[model samples]
Target: METKEENFPNDSTMESIKSLTEKDAKTFLNLIYALIKDNENPSEQLISNVLTIFEKQLPRVAKARQNKN
Candidate 1:
């Protein structure tokens, strides 16, 4: 898949973070570390805040598949 910054909302970037794939998640985790690792202050709380507004598409997809059964 193409990784485009514009693919997501700038105003709600945190919300978008929650919906990332496993690979994307790993990449993002690394990014977070890179941003804060040097400061001795990486915030897990910030990550959770982002996830709070994030919606999970996998569950919806699974539900749709079940409905098609």
Candidate 2:
């Protein structure tokens, strides 16, 4: 059986994502799952709102990555 690690090797996003608290991570994950599990694609504003929530939770992580570039 293929493990998740083998399925998604070299995931650079994980390093930045690890900065999120477990509760925040789970909340964001639930939001993503809700989007995918729906039949229709979400509206642009809905997507933007979800991204805004994520940014609020990880402002420092976002700023750090921006500074690195």
Candidate 3:
């Protein structure tokens, strides 16, 4: 069975993050902050899923930023 990380496209590039724009990034950050600040009790499965997404995707974003400097 394919995992969510495997199912997610590996074709993300710097262009994608760049396209997120300041406003979009701010909105996304706000949403994440709200979720964290609210003390929402996420299920283990939900936390696992989100962590998987972050592990798979955030490195690319970080790498892209690193390369930009």
lDDT of each: 0.49, 0.59, 0.57
Residue 40 in candidate 3, Cα distance off native in Å: 2.7
Q: Report the C-alpha lDDT of model 2 over 1-69, residue by residue, as the tens digit.
A: 868665342434455476556775676788777865672755765666555555454565545655876
Each candidate's root-mean-square deviation in Å? 11.6, 8.2, 8.1
Model 2: how far residue 20 lies from native, Å:
0.7
As for lDDT, the candidate ahead, 1 or 2, is 2
The lowest-lDDT stretch of 10 consecutive residues in candidate 3 is: 7-16
Q: Number of clashing residue pairs in every model?
A: 0, 0, 0
* Preferred candidate (lDDT higher): 1 or 3: 3
How far off is residue 22 in model 1, in Å? 0.4
TM-score of each: 0.32, 0.41, 0.42
Better of 1 and 3 by TM-score: 3
Residue-level lDDT of model 3, residues 1-69, one tens digit each, is 768766453555434455555765675566556656765576655556555445555556556656776
The positional error of residue 39 in candidate 3, measured at the CA in angstroms, is 2.2
Candidate maximizing TM-score:
3
- Per-residue lDDT tens digits for candidate 1, residues 1-69, read 637764454543444454445776675457556655554434665544334333343344434444766
